[model samples]
Target chain A: MLRIEGLTAEVDGKPILKGIDLEVPAGEVHAIMGPNGSGKSTLSYVLAGREGYEVTGGSATLNGVDLLGMEPEERAAAGVFLAFQYPVELPGVGNANFLRTALNAIRRGKGESELDAMQFLKLARARLKELQMSEDMLKRGVNVGFSGGEKKRNEVLQMALLRPSLAILDETDSGLDIDALKIVADGVNALRAPDFSALVITHYQRLLDYIVPDKVHVLMQGRIVQTGGPELAKQLEASGYASVQAAA
Target chain B: MNTVVHSGAEGFLHRFEGLRARLPGQRLAWVQALREAAAEQFRVAGFPTRRVEAWKYTDLRPVSDAAFDEALTILGDGDTLPAPRGERRAVFVDGRFREELSQIEGASFAIGSLAEELPRLEGRLGALARPAEESLVALNTMLFEDGLLVTVPTGVAGGVLELCSLASRSERPSAFHPRHLIRLESGASLTIVEEASGPEDTRYLHNPVFEIELAEGAVLTHARIQREGVKGFQLGTVYARIEAGATYDNFTLNAGARLVRNEIHAVLAGPKSACHMNGAQLLRAGQHADTTTVLDHAAPDCASRQTYKTVLQGKSRGVFQGKIHVHQVAQRTDGYQMNQALLLSPDAEIDSKPQLEIYADDVKCSHGATVGALDADQLFYLRARGIPEAKARSILVEAFLQEAIEGVTDETARAALESAVAGWWEKEAA
Candidate 1:
């Protein structure tokens, strides 16, 4: 389970996430829907331990392990994964080489024997096939010259390969089309198990139609104002975030 | 040569006066005149300082301050040399050829020590170089004891050849100036991998000068790797002249030495000739490396391309100066140059200058330079993917150098460069 209490964060001396209290139990997928300045992305970045995001007062944990006190790679080893809205492009870095290195690093952290190149290639090719991505991606530089849809699909492919217990999708469906959205949703749904949980943060209700969340929370002004079942996402779609803003 | 006296360069001039009769090719009148003219130039100019335009970024105070004695005899037979990178090897110890340590049994082309081949190298030795113009070249021309001399016959494809310069461990500070002469006849081709290395704690100088001549329809690929000791200094220069339909491809990697300067002067003197120069400089704390090149387009329809990358860590410094000159009669010339630097620490420094002087109206020349630290977003992305911080930094550094290494076409040379880069990362991370 992933839990957060009184999460207050600032960027460059300005508050962005204030008093954010949320929790997602195991075997559940929750969605956080908000407007442009609702600080949705900031929440995910803070949870991932990115630099420059100063946490004034916050307590976040996964399975009773403190998340705020560890490095980004340590948080990843503790089963925290953040799918970036803008995937960084790494020129001259081959995708196959990068994925293998990441996987081997995590495995080493878990005291697991590392996989050789051929074995890692087999696993990566299988994951690419499931995501419907071309094997040519393994040959080129990571995210270099990739289209918008291709970048999104690459993120999903990474999430599948890493297989983190707690995944955070921050505005992943922004530039994706319906078909691409379905592929991403299937990738997430395929990892649904008793030990898996996810926090799907998005803006529109169209993505929720494909991957129905167990719970939906209305976030406004860096705070969660209301919480309900999946029907809250549909209700917000009919009545925009303005209604939630007024109620808060 | 007369016992001319100069202030800053008197140390070398005094040595040249004492070693004139014992130097190689002393029996030839042309060689004597060449040495005398070079000595005269060195006597007048001395070692270059910061005031000079070409030596603005690099300072040679460390070289001039210390008195460097000459290595009189060869190292003992117990000394080990670096492994050869090609089939044929020509080894040089303390700038003198070591025939027993070399392995050039069945070489198709002509390869021998310049000291032994001085009779055959009458006018070709000093034909390409301008010792009267450059101080370092003049210093090398006056004091060079021995070097490699290679010549390929017409239409023959001379295979891979390794020229290794190893500086022996000495108790006192010493210096060696090796002058190499390489020529390829028309329609001939050859690949040369030049490796220079020394003991980890030796205080010495390995100043080499190369004079290359490429005839019509000929090609030469030269790759140089400099890994001098921590207390050593290296100041090397190369002069190449490309004729019609010839190509001069050169790549250099600077990863060692307390201070180093590698200079190249390439002149495209014939129509349709090309010159491709690429290099990477990797420096750590207390290290300084410089790569300077001057490309001259003297004929019409010629092309030149240059790309250089420098990665600095700790308190190290890096410098790159590239100039492309197009003559008035050189119409339809194409020239491009780019230099990029990545500073790994706040204390690291880089000085990059890209210059272009084009007199032709139909020429196309472009130059660019970029200096930056590692990208934060890229670093975070890699860390978030579970790669350790040190590993991620190494990965990014390797990626930045890969672009420059790709321009090297020869497989053997490229492999040698890749291994050197890997070794650098290992030492850095440790």
Candidate 2:
């Protein structure tokens, strides 16, 4: 469902991701573990089509379609989602209203019928309940004054509502407590289907224990240096990235 | 070399002199003296320019150069009052109050023309009619024909009072000086919504002045909505005095005029008085809007809060100058002021100066001003959520202005102001 080959990205003339190759088939989950500044977040941003990140030499495709050429909104409408490491706080935009707009935008782009306010509210209420969130969250401004765990859960809620085919979780587990980590993992695990794929980016092996990735890759200095099964996470957590860096 | 004295400053002074000479009834000595003093001040101050420190960002050259003749009497049939929308309506046409169209239903309310009330309270007129140092205020005082005077009796709950000023004409460059005097007696509570509108194609000048007096323990909610014509020029001044234990709240929304200036001067005269002033200005195209305010804390334990937001697009310009002054005697004073501007276009400009002057060591005062374009990261975040770029920008802009609008106490008036803001956004996009 998602593929990246020779992805060389640079920010501010400094090459961050030298070369990256990754693939996640439908119904599979791939975990990318890296040290700080090893371009774990850069890969997600590049895949999400954020501006100012120069893709010097790379090709990223989703479902055999070139994702690099699309705008951020276009990529979103094409079923690409990025759960931000830090969710932005929109001071006046209500959470429910923003979710409805986003849902309708994606649905309209795909030639689907748009949901009315009543329908949108019903759908949002059920999703919020499923995520163990209160209806009061819908009335407040989007993520404004939200606790760290609440922001992470809100991001998962958005992913569930949008139902993007390809989801990139960039450091989504960094700030989550143990309970929040389980809730977020449950959210991700529930969305795992034959048509949906995920790229989980994290700095520790803690999140992997909950989500249980199908494949694990060690990213060092902007390149994938090692690949293994779930045991790779355990080895890395036991030995740390210093040995990984020495080996690379 | 033969040089003509531009009619910009002198013509209005001459017309005011002519009006004074034609007065038939016996006038109060203090009223006459105030008129003369205002005329002299107008003559000396002339017109404000960009060189003045206070008016550094706004130049009144266009208004000074325009030949604004004294507006002739425009007495309309009672049918043109635009059907009163709220309780207690006062209509002012061409700067003069129309008693026939006004509706004063309650017995505790007294509504009349300031000119008519001047002779009766000659001694109080001087105290209320202190000459404002600004050139526009001086001009409005010198040339004002008649203004609205409203007073709510002590311990009276006057409900809501609507002051509507409508200027409609296509002939001469008419000018209106609509002054408002509102006195809320002790323990009295009132809500005043000042609505100003005019023909979209008319080229007129509106120089309005509102003087408010809040007795001890009184509460006043004053909201001013300016929807003047696109070709019009508006220069309005609001001077309010708050006594001990009184509460004064003001909200000003400017979405009109080619050039507009709304100045507010508030004084917390007695201990424990509080004042809250908030405003929003949305300007597009070649529009120029200015909001200048000063809060004087003269008594101990007084508090003041101010917030002003401006959104500029196209070639528009916005100016905000807010100052908080805590006197030496005003110990334990708490004052905060903030001015923020969102520049939607590269060519748009915003000049903001938030100042705080505190002579008391025990005072708490702070001021901040910021000018920037929309956050690119936020924009991208919204876009990634499948929201379009235009809608994302509007959402952010609305968020930026929401805090100011939330300060409006009246729900209906607040909704109206929000609608006005939405209308401005629609026009700006078009």
Candidate 3:
């Protein structure tokens, strides 16, 4: 459901994501494994339409619609969700309010009726329950003073609430513990459907163990050098990115 | 200290000479003398200039050139006091109390116009609010039309008092000075909401002076929301003297008027009293709102706090000046002041001054101020959640002001203020 052909991007006049090609079909979970400065996060940010990341020469599409042409909110409305590695701390914006606004915004964009406060609270409570999150976290400021695990969990919770068609989890397992990883993986696994797809960007292979990917892509120097089955992650863990870099 | 007289005040001096004959309480000898003395004070001091520290951020030259005379027309036909049903209300049109619209007949405490109760209010009229160094206060004292008077009986808990001020229908811009008096007897209590508003697109001046005195063990909660006409000018001052075991809590929301200033002077006169001054200023597009307060801890064991927040956008300006003074005998006093502003535009400006003068040996006093823009990461995060850029901005601005708005203790008052802020944001966004 997601396609990137020759996805070249840059930040601060310096090339980050040089020509890259990748695709994730419907109902499949794809894991992108790379070391630091490999442009994995850059690709995720470009997909999410964040500022300061200029897509120089390539085209990325979700559901065959141009992603880079839309603003951040428009991209969100078009079902592009990004689970940030470090969720921003909003001092006065409550998590529950933020979730409701986002849900209603997307729903409105799709010409659907917005949910009332009662309905929103009920829906948010149920989602939090499924994600093993407490209601108190939703009452407080979004990601303010939250632990690393809580921030990641909140990101996953947001993904669960939005239920995007193409979800991009950028380094979701970076600061997570074993339990948090399992919870986050469960949150993603529950959203699996014939129309749902995910691109999981991770440094380690541990996250893929819980949410097994149908395909594995090795990204080195702004290019996806290799694509193989899920067992490719096992081999990469056994060895290291040094071999992959030399091969690329 | 040398005083710098402004030409703006000199013009006002000429305007007051013709308006003095029609001032209220003309029959009362003390009241007339009080007005004359205040006029003399205005002549001597003139308007405070930029050379003076207090009037540095604000200038009265623009207001001086406006041709706003006395409000000649009262509440006309089809006019209504916007007070909610069942709430105690004392409505005023052009600084004159509207007895027909006012619903203070059956309130537990006494409420009437200053003109009707001048005999009873003579002793306390100019007592609490003696306009000495301030030219605006002096001008208000000299040219006041008619104001409300509320007196809570001793040992009785009073209900919510709604003191509302609405501008009248006038072709040319009009000006009104209202002198309100509030007295709470020993062991008395009261909560008051003062709202100042006018017809949209009208140019008027609402200069009101409030004198509040809380006796021993009394409690007073005052919330003033100033939503004058968008093109109007509002300059108001409040003087409160809190007694032993008394508590005076005041909260103001400055959201309207092209040029607005709300000044407050609170004195803790008895031991163990407390006073809190908290407010929020929301301005957009050439609006200028200022809030200045002075807290005096004159007795031992008194506590005072001042917290203010301002949000400015589109070339707007905001000013906050607060001072806390602890007397030598005021040992164990606790005084704190904080001012913060959020600038939503590059052209927006905020000036804050916080001062503390402590003579007591054992006292805790601290002050701080901050001026900054909205966090970029916060805006991006909100926008990423599908909220539009404008919606995200208003949410953060409201949140920034909520820190000070939350200081209002009463629930009904808090809700009223919150809804008012929401309404202002809606209009601003639109």
Candidate 4:
């Protein structure tokens, strides 16, 4: 479960997420649709504890554990994952090795036995196949020389490997074609379960169609203006953010 | 003469006359001439000072003042060598070639001591190293004791040859100078792995030089790994010259010694020849490693590359100086040089100078130098996956060095160097 109450944050001393209040219970996928400057990414970064984002006020917690007080890695150890809109390129790190290291790191943090190279490779290959990513991508450097679609799928791949309880997909559907959108959606949909939850941040309803959400929240100007059933997405698509804001 | 007061270079000159009788090939005229000339050069340029452009970043005064003598030959029966991954291994204890300790695979081509083959190898000894302006190389030529002579006949693929220099346990601070000569005839090829190591507590100086000559169409791969004693000091140099259509590849890994300087000079003498000079240096506290290279492109259409990476931890210091010289006639020459350093600690320091002197307007040459700490973005990327900060830092450093290590074409050599890097990571983690 994820909860945010008046989670105000700032970047470069400029207020962004003024006062966001939201909750995503277990076994549900939530969609946050907003305009370009609605602080959607700012919210995700604050939750993930990325440096340079000052939490001005309010609190955010996962399962009653304070998330803002943790390091980026500590938050990850506490089952918080943020899939960046643009995955950072590691010039010389192999993708397979990165996956294994991340998996083992989380495993060790949780007091579980770490997976050896063989076990990690086996698990990675299976999940990569499901995401339609070639095994060659495993040999290449992480996110290096990768296409836009492959980069997004790699984010989903990490989500699969770490199996985080709260995955904040920041603009996961920003740069995908129809086919790439379907594959990425398939990867996310496959991970849908009672224990797994995601905050799919997007500006379009196309991705929401592929990975249908249980709750749709219209985020406008750093605040969630409206929260409704899945049909709220369709209504917003037909009219726009202006009409949605007026109605709210 | 008054200026040579208890200085390192003066110390060598003081013992030169008495040590001449113990020197190998003492009876040979050309060998004696070389010694006299080199000794004269060393005396003229005492120990290089900071004012010297080449020695600007490295100060040799601290450990250089210690008295050094010939290591007493004390071979321990319990001292075992790692399995010879090469076809033959010419092992040296202290500065003398050990017949019983060495492993010579077969009689393929002429392979023996320079002392025994002095008459035949006299003219070829310093032929490749024409420019001995580097005082250290000149010093090595003067006090040279014993080394190996590996010659590959035309068109013969000389299997991997490991030239090993092992310093036996010595009570007092001692020194050794080994002059290794490698000559590959036209169409011949060889892979050489040179390893230098010594006892942990034995304070010594190992000054080694490699003279390499590749004829037209010859290919030679030289991988040198220096894991000297922590209390030891090493001043190693490689001088290589390649002819038409020949290929020369040299890789070095510096992992030990309290102070070390691995210098390489490569010349492309003919058209269409290619040369690759690469190395990696890993240093911890109280350690200093420097790798300097000079690549000369004398003919057109020749290609040369130099990549050196250093990972400095604790209060260690690392330096890299690479210079590419494209001569007037070397049109169409392609030369690339890069030096990158990763400073793990705030006290760690790196000085990198990548230079290009292009006389040929038609040539293409590029040089790059970078001094940076572990990348924050890369660290966050790894740590965000639940990896601890220390582990993430190690992974990124390994990745940084592995990029240059991948340039080593020989698979086994790459693996050996990779494991060495991994071993460094483990030690740092501990």
Candidate achieving the largest DockQ: 1
Per-residue lDDT of model 4, residues A1-248, tens digit only: 99999989899999998899999997899999998999998888888877789999999889888999988888899998989898999988898888888988888888899999888889888988888888898899999999999899899899988999888888898889999999989988898899888999998888999989999998888889999988988888999899977876
Error of 2 at A44 (Å): 0.8
- Per-residue lDDT tens digits of candidate 1, residues B96-152? 998998988888899989999887788888898888789889999998888999999
In angstroms, how far off is B202's CA in candidate 2? 2.6
Better of 1 and 3 by lDDT: 1
Ten-residue stretch with the least lDDT total in model 1 chain B: B72-81
Question: Which ranges in model 1 have alpha carbons more than 4 Å from their true place?
Answer: B1-5, B73-80
Against the true structure, whose TM-score is highest?
1
TM-scores of the candidates are 0.98, 0.92, 0.95, 0.94
Per-residue lDDT of model 3, residues A1-248, tens digit only: 89999989999999999998999999999999999999999999898888899999988888899988998988888888888888998876778888899899988877789999999999889999999999998899889899999999999898888888989999999988999999999999999999999999999999999999999999998999999999999999998999887776
Rank the models by DockQ, top first.
1, 4, 2, 3
lDDT at residue B235 of model 2 (Cα atoms): 91
What DockQ does every candidate get?
0.88, 0.70, 0.68, 0.73
- Order of models, best TM-score first: 1, 3, 4, 2
- TM-score of chain B, candidates 1 onward in order: 0.97, 0.93, 0.94, 0.95
Collision pairs in model 2: none
What TM-score would candidate 3 get against the native? 0.95
lDDT of 4 at B9: 80
